[model samples]
Target: MVQPFSQSRVKPEQNLKSLSSFNEAVRLLRESNSIVITTHINPDGDGIGSELALSRALRYADRMEDSKAGLHKPKTISIINVNPTPRNYQFLDVDNEIRTFDETRDAPTILQADLVVVLDTNHPMRLRTMEPYVLRSNAQKLCIDHHLDTSNFADVYLIDEEASSTGEIVMKVVEELTSHQIDAQMATCLYAAIMTDTGSFRYPRTDAELHRTIADLLELGADPTYIYDQIYDQWSPNRLRLLGNALSNIRVLYDGKLAIMTVTQEMLSATATTDAETDNFSTYPMSIAGVLLGVLLVELPDGVKMSFRSKGD
Candidate 1:
């Protein structure tokens, strides 16, 4: 039987006002065993990248020769998510460690976890179908996210909304956990996280420190060109055709202040493309000369899905 979250044995650290929150988070993670890592549903690069990076870092504990170094490694460190990794991001799963959650298959793992680290999201509902199990689990919960919403569900919150990405927050935690010597695998994941979230380092969050971090990642064996190619250059003919069809339907609204495009089931079928092929398709509308806001309306079987992006503010 899983324990209730409120009864967690770990006491909150004294200094909630300072970096002690981070220190305490690190302490809880270091002391925990049977750890399970997860992120939000339909995860983007930041969520997936952060999950993989932290998973790799935690796995390092098992390799440590010194058992007395206070590396209280869990017997199992599982990376599970509500949805499958996007086709393009599959390259980062070098270890093939990410598993999709199934109620029958993964509920036991969730229930048995001594610590559940939720990355890139703070709300349990963001966990989708896995929310109930995560909420009921007696394990200590830790949230490492950059989203503005800091709704207090997790026992430990390592949130920095000002940070470029959740990957940035995870980088700091990983460094603190590993004594600042991150492995190449960690670097690749973090690089992907920051890269996608910052729109290839052009977003407002891309500061000097972020550039330095990217430089360090490059020095530590992250192949930026290869990563970019894998994510952007590998589109199939069907996907391109689908994009062409969607773009043809672009509609200017609010006197060019908004650009709207729709990808319907008929268009997808005509183009021989799956819905997954439309991932990040909203960027196309935003690229218009005078568009300030871009919207992509995807026609799902049950409903219409919408995504919005803005030029500024």
Candidate 2:
């Protein structure tokens, strides 16, 4: 199962150790002529949003430089991912620039890039089949992530586990790149990334600063109510039936402290739903009154998939 984007947050000051590396990353971006940007497989909001925002920022910066230098050649900035963007996130890819990786088709593009920016996750394994090709490339790797690094594969790791989301870190980098200018598109993507990862500003890491950042995003043309509805409210009828089918199998355990819900392929077929429609199904069990921990078991063709959500440590 895909993991939730939310994680523990450290103080922002704790990330100061990577300041030098962050500077190096920015310098590399300035020097590189061709760049490739990628995120983890089955990317969630943070990964996709950060990638889009960074792509836009880099292109804008490149255009600005071209204008100043009186050069007409364009910098190639490719935003490729191991998995196709999900339906819900297609709105964020306004330019239709995001591409799905294919070994034969995208291999040359990945290899020829002067720099590759891996966002949201530092682990190379998250790159899936593209990991080997990325490793083979002579391109310098830069990671901008909020997750704790278990493996250091990138040449420059601009990691900040305290960041509310990778988009938050990308926001700062965009500011540096574009001289503190964030357009409506950048604002919308970053706002969605931070909002979803912070559980709609209800999560533990959502501080006053984050709220202020959100306010800035709103001022930049991010519509809070509309974005929220686009992400959460536009569920299909089949999805609602699938949720009902899963809820019908809910069971209590350990004196109501634990709740378990199971959804089989048969249930999906019966409800005329697909795995995509079942997004956030794990949250249902956690919403039970006395349930401290919720577990969702989904039966897929490969095997049974499990997701766990807990209220406390």
Candidate 3:
């Protein structure tokens, strides 16, 4: 669905022929006065975590390395989110550093950037209300994502579809940005990103490379059990009730090849459950042998949010 070019798209790997562009990107960041970084709308953990880690790396290098004969701290790097994240990601504490801004109120701050880095989004429309500022910013733009389906709207776009998660891309960029080892906080951020995107190491995307990276993260202080507990263990009693209702009301479609569940506004009100609690409500159907796809139809105040997940053949 990307435009501005045709079937002859220049892949990131293909574009890596010149070290000049790569050096230009790093230099641009190194010279930027004020940076405003953001991710696609509905930022998942991978996007959020990458923005934080990247900013951290840039700042770390600035703090330790002097730009002109070791005399400057670089500029400020601001991380913004198009919208709030799912509750499970709250544990990341990205709110403390990156700061989330409402586009309605903070238009000026968004437009006045020397550099804009958009993460995780493939389609340009996915940038949401912040899209205008991204376009208007005379500042350079960079795209760091893991989706092959991307629009080269930025100057430096490093995308890798083979990556298990955007966090992996972030890891590579972090190493390039700074040689410093991953700290506990960095490991925690990365672990959250990789774990969620790869379905806790259960997704088919999880390969040896992913495992090796995760092992390195573990040595750097990634604790799977604790992070899993924080991400998945916390549940409200009403959420349990909602889960039960969802499982009971689910239907097998496509002659038991697909499973479907619907969460009406009434169901939400009845169980005192918010939208976040229904994260895995469709998984019950996915566990069934014949079901290859599980779809959840959630009715919101205005419209509906549809979630689709594929399992087996």
Candidate 4:
């Protein structure tokens, strides 16, 4: 079984290594005049939240620097993603800064930017349609992510696999960039990112430090109740019915150690719900008594998307 949160503290050496990357990344941000930020295709809460929060923080820092130097030219920052923001996460983009990538328009921006910041995923392929452009760009690339097995595409990498989410790592960077002056909007985005990726702080990597970070976010104006409601409570009636259908069809196997749930295209059409509505369906199977592993298989037009949730190592 996965270890308890109390037993999963981050190692000291990991912090030191992460700090070095952080320093390099901050220096690059300070020098860049124009920047483009993006996340993986079909982004989850962690990716979207980190992208928005980091972009906002960078712009805020630029404005502060401009005021102090009496310079009107602030760094130009654009958030371009391969896919449109999910309906649920649209609330966090309060300023509506996120733009769906258009090759004709965004290609030039990517090529012209002094820096390109890729959040959440480390692999360039995860950027999908934007991958070639990102690779072709001469801009200094910086990747901020929490996943393992990173590609060497970026000029600077701020990666911490031990982090609960990319949002957690971005929180530290935001603090350093803004001098601990995180605003309410940024706090809300980070809170949503960390909360969702940590499964509401119940995941294995969640620990005292993570909770402390959450507390800091709350004090900075992240409303947990509101964010939770916005993300989970806003599900459509058809979406809830789709979940019910999936639960009803769950198949138990291996003497109750495994549970499998399948959502076919027919099921989706019947319920008038799309595949995106099946985000957390795997969690339901893992919640069953005596089940060690849960598998959610969603059949799309082209292929099947599989999600796994397991209780043990």
Per-residue CA lDDT of model 1 for 1-313, tens digit only, reads: 1111111212345224326677777788777878889999999889999989887877675556246556543457899999999988898999999999999999999998989999988888999999999989999999988888688788988777667899988887787777667888889999999999999999887888789889988888889998899877998988899999899889998989899999999998898887878898989899998899999999988889999998866
Q: Tell me how far the alpha carbon of residue 268 in candidate 3 is from the true structure, in angstroms, after superposition.
A: 0.9
Residue-level lDDT of model 4, residues 56-146, one tens digit each, is: 8998998888888986678899999999998889999999999999999999999989999999999999889899999999999999998
Q: Name the runs in model 4 displaced over 4 angstroms.
A: 1-16
lDDT of 2 at 19: 61
Clashes per candidate (backbone, < 3 Å): 1, 0, 1, 0
lDDT of 2 by residue, 1-313 (tens): 1111222343445434456666777888878889999999988888998999889999999888888888656789999899999888888899999999988999999988999999998899999999998988999999898887448788887877777889888887887888878899999999989988898988776777788788999998898888788778888888888898889889999999999999899999998887767778888899999899999888888998888999976
Number of the top-ranking candidate, with lDDT as the measure: 4
Arranged by TM-score with the best first, the candidates are: 4, 2, 1, 3
Candidate 2: Cα lDDT at 110: 91
What are the clashing pairs of model 3? 66-70
lDDT (Cα atoms) of all candidates against the true structure: 0.84, 0.85, 0.75, 0.89
Provide the global lDDT of candidate 2 against the true structure. Answer: 0.85
In angstroms, how far off is 177's CA in candidate 2? 0.8
lDDT value, residue 214 of candidate 3? 92
